[model samples]
Every structure is written in structure tokens, then in C-alpha cells.
Target: MVLVQTKIVFHVDELNKWPEVLSNVTNVLMDLAQHDDHHIQMVVVANGDGIMGYLIPSINDQISELAKTVEFHACHNSMVSHGLNSARIPSGVHIVPVGVIDLASLQDNGYRYLKP
Candidate 1:
């Protein structure tokens, strides 16, 4: 049997889309759990107004739990634009220099892009 690794990058730019994005990530992880031959690498990149979601206590808690199994990225540019400093970001989430550019770089490195 051949093993396959799937890399996925999820882009979220709207605050309201956080729930949907979380749901999508949960579903993907569940689906991947059943497939023994496939390995998954997932990252959720938040930019634009979506960065505000990180400031929400409830959402941050949820994201913190999920961070154990999935990667989370916050855009530095967006954070600055929204008046958020690095200290405001959750513990496990990474801060990227630029969201769109990071997305492009991930795609170039073989990660499939998903927006919800």
C-alpha cells in the first residue's frame, strides 16, 4: 500500500465564517481519521476582519483546543491593521507576515487551498 500525505490550507477573512471554518476542519479531521493510508497536514490562516475572532474569548478557547491537532496562522499585517499586537494572539497560533502571500506560498508548496 502506498501512503499519501494531503496538505490543506484554510483561508478565513470574515468574522462570521469562524464557525463554518471550525466545522470544516473538524469534518476533515474526522474523515482523515478513518483513512489509514492518508496523512493530513492542515492549517487555518485568518486575515482581514477575521482576525477579530481570535479576540473573542469563546472562539479563542475552541481554537486553542483544536491547535493541538491542526496548525493556526494569524496574519501580522491584518493584526496591525486591526490594532492587535502579538500578545493578543492565542498561544499556539503562528503569526505570518502577510496572509495572502502566505497562502500563495503554501499553495506553491503543494497545499490545497480551502475557503469557507
Candidate 2:
């Protein structure tokens, strides 16, 4: 039997959307886990003000929990623009040169784009 791969990239650009985005990520993972025919590759990319969520203790903890099942990415451009440094980023989160470009590249490679 062949297992199909489903690639999904979640984009978050606003700080206020972290809760919703996290909820959506949890739901998506749960929904997909019920099926065995597909292998999932999920990524959450935060840019703009959304990267600020990583500095908040509460949100950061929540993200760290989900990081075990979802890959997390932060935009270096956004961090620099907001005067944030690598030390402020939570563990398990990757630093990307640019969020928009990364999103485009993922989509071009057949990963579905989701903004929540």
C-alpha cells in the first residue's frame, strides 16, 4: 500500500491570531491522525507581529507543546524589524530568512497554504 503525503503550511502574521492558529493546528492534526492513508508534514510560519507571540511566556509554552507535532518557523526579517533577537525565540522554532518567500516556496512545492 502506498501512503500519500499531505503537506500544509500555516501562516500567521498577526499576534492576535496565535490562539486561533494554535487551535486550528491542534484540530488539523487530530483530524488527520484518524486516517492512516496519509502522512502529514505540517509547518507553522510566523512573521510580522505574529513573531511577538514567541516572546510571551504563555503563548510560547503552548507553542512549545505543539512543536512536537508541528514544525515552527519564525521570520528573521520580522525579528530584526521588531528589534527582537534569536535569544527571544522559543526552542524548537526555526529561523527563516523571510516568511513570505518561505511561504511562497512551500506553496510552489505543493504545500497547501493556510492563514488563520
In the predicted model 2, the residue pairs found to clash are: none
In model 2, the Cα lDDT at residue 79 comes to 100
Q: Rate the local accuracy (lDDT) of all candidates.
A: 0.94, 0.91
lDDT of 2 at 109: 91
Please write out the lDDT profile of model 2 over residues 1-98, one tens digit for every residue. Answer: 78989899999999999999889888888888898887888899999999998998988888878888889999999999999999889878999999
Whole-model alpha-carbon lDDT for candidate 1:
0.94
Question: Could you give candidate 1's per-residue lDDT for residues 1-116 as a string of tens digits?
Answer: 89999999999999999999999998988998899999999999999999999999988988988898999999999999999999999999999999999999999999999998
Location of the lowest summed lDDT over 10 successive residues in candidate 1: 57-66
| Every candidate's CA RMSD | 0.9, 1.2
Question: Best by lDDT, which number?
Answer: 1
- Per-prediction count of colliding residue pairs? 0, 0
